[model samples]
Target: MAGHSKWANIQHRKGRQDEKRGKVWTRIIREITVAARQGGADVTANPRLRLAIDKAKAANMPADRIKYNVDKASGNLEGVNYEEIRYEGYGIGGAAIIVDTMTDNRVRTVAEVRHAFSKYGGNLGTEGSVAFQFKHCGQLVFAPGTSEDKVMEVALESGAEDVVSDDDGAIEVITSPTDFEAVKNALEAAGLVADMAEVTMRAENTIAIAGEDALRMQKLLDVIEDLDDVQNVYHNAELAE
Candidate 1:
């Protein structure tokens, strides 16, 4: 990840979200429903639900729409039941990938996922195949030129685990999943707003792939992400912007 700033990676993800803006609401609603159903509707008692709501707000989802989905999933109203699934695989150049999905039909979901992998220059692997290469945690990445000292001070005071400044000038604050909200709030209060903040499966290491290989790998990822049941896509490949 040397030449690529952490903020660059965040922008890549944001760019992908923008490209699929039409489906953003659909994805957020599914996430809200699933999080609520699994952990109950009380945001205070349910960290997962709270995170889902945070994403909804970031996507500009309406307050009433968010609450309706939460209540519906909590059984206060009617909603579709979803089951979470994780698919691991190798992309072009053996880049590791993990796809997180929530679906009512595992049959259709798996078929579509497997088909997408096969359609591209990749192969879906067994459970835990690429998962071992990732760590589930909360990550807050600041844009290049942000004040590293201030970010470090506020993040540490707010329960962040580590703060690192990339050679390229992006600052990253890592925290345990449960402590993410507090750290993010503290940093924002301190005027150190992050470019990206989320509970994510971050790659412990990276694989750099460029040229045609990079293009193919990105296509594989985009296809997997476009699936209706897919919630998130994580990969170790750092492609050129």
Candidate 2:
């Protein structure tokens, strides 16, 4: 598995704990609000909203809460206006990092992000600073017991770029953003259930950071992700097991 995949696995494990604390529901609600605001309240017609709703449902977010947030986003109720932003930076040991956020105030969000990086021995960079070092790809993960060869065959047939089997017993499929839904549907039709699916920024190359640098990188990621405005953190830090 790649660093991104490793980080995702870590998050999944931590997410259960987050759920108990109600943090997962907050994040899911933010995503739902943003998605509905951007693409309207119709889940069937709004792909982004559809995905967010699916995630919310999977997380066991209450149906009434989901509807409330969707209504808030669609102007049926009052809510904060959010703008999506991406921050590119470098973490300890020069590992490239990308932070995705949805905030009502861009100035406050950027300052908070910059402060976290600088405090953690990292530096915030200009736009496109480290983006070129990564590839924006669609990822769909399948759990263990799914036939790898069968899954790979369907993914490739549905325009996926690659299928990689990991030691964690999960299979990760890569595809272009436009082909993601099709590829996912194909796999599902073949009796494969996707554990997680998202369009993510994947590092084309990664840096192996050990000891102090690795610890610093994790702290930086935690700081960024703990921000209420931040949604996702992508980095090239090769987290050791």
Candidate 3:
């Protein structure tokens, strides 16, 4: 809509996805494989793997390719091992940033991540420097004009923690990470399709940035997001609309 909802960010992200389909697929594959390796290949029994598979499907990845990676990670075939890492930092306007990565080469990944931050007007901080500013949860955002009462009724009944409507008319439903899939399914069954839905590290507060600072911050986020080893980038900067 016209405000700072997850849907707005997702629309921006979707616009960027087409130009980086290959890179996006690469990241999704890594996520699927890692999830499978950590929690078996059965989607029904493995929530993380199920979520990864959903992402792969959303990206239009071939089912066979997805299955292959899952098998490889689950020991049916050979695969490269990966380790998950989190990097914290401060971006323009003193806003906090968190980068989540999964890589087979930790040294190379860290160097690349550090270089992006340093070159983009940001400072890479030590572990735990910025993570505390975020809360990890599931978020679903509906576009403006949706029925707030209906969303609230359905969401609360389905285990959502909160249903909030912004000034712009967008409605956001928040839920625990473990209840994400169930809530999403419930919403779908009730014919309430969300414009954006994901499990993410949400910032507790936002720092407004505008003019030159906003531009620099957007560039910093873009470069960091474009990094091959970077999986997810979370920040608390609310760029001027």
Candidate 4:
């Protein structure tokens, strides 16, 4: 869990840098559109939509853009009918990788993803090939000032599975999928604003890769994440300390 936390912190910091370049807004828009399409446009009623909106707000995305995307998705305003897709594979040093994407064309996304793997010294695998090594959990990250004990108490009372440390100035609360919204709301009510919250696939075990392999693994992640269709990239590469 400490390793997971550390990696999350790194990603969070990287995300802040990416935000300055406007890439984060693009990613958030895609995520919000998908969430709206799947769960309706009402943030109060759609938990996933609410999470997406929160992310947009955190990234300083314009309210008009957020509303426009939600409306476009829920109103089906004649655009790409984006679909959620997951790609499983191995990274440098045999570290398992899982990439989440939103694309209108599966064929193109698959080719692009596979090319990334191959070019980075790895190969793509079938649907369930590497997913079995991971577990799906709802993770909620708290702001730096949030009290750990208070957050933990709220999480536990709301049926959270675990609360752990993160390398970022935050804490992560893991909850069952069904309990995600409830737990998030509980923590928020207790004055803990979540830095990031999402249901993600987490690797059950990680493989330590060092030196050149570590650099290759990071490069593979960067390539995958740079893909326009990619939403999230998960892997079992033990993050270098």
Worst lDDT window (10 residues) for model 2? 1-10
**Candidate 2 lDDT score at position 135:** 87
* Candidate 3 lDDT score relative to the true structure: 0.89
| Worst window of 10 by summed lDDT in candidate 3 | 1-10
Give the winner by TM-score: 3 or 4: 3
lDDT per residue as tens, model 2, 140-205: 877766788898889999899998876667788999987888898888888887877888897787
For model 1, residues 36-63, the per-residue Cα lDDT tens digits are 8888999999988988899899888889
Ranking of candidates on lDDT, top first: 3, 1, 2, 4
lDDT of 3 by residue, 130-234 (tens): 999998999888888999888889999999998877666789888999999999999989999898788999887778788999899999999999988899899
The TM-scores of all predictions, comma-separated, are: 0.95, 0.89, 0.95, 0.87
Q: Candidate 2, residue 151: CA error in Å?
A: 1.0
Give the TM-score (vs. native) of candidate 3: 0.95
lDDT of 4 by residue, 1-241 (tens): 4534454534654664565457677778888888888889888889888888888887778888888899998975755688889999998878999999989899999999999999989899999999999889998877666788888888998899998866555778898887988898888888787766778886777787879888888888888888989888888787564
- Candidate RMSDs in order: 1.7, 2.6, 1.9, 2.8
- RMSD of candidate 3 to the truth, in angstroms, is 1.9
Residue 127's lDDT within candidate 3 is: 95
Model 4 earns a TM-score of 0.87
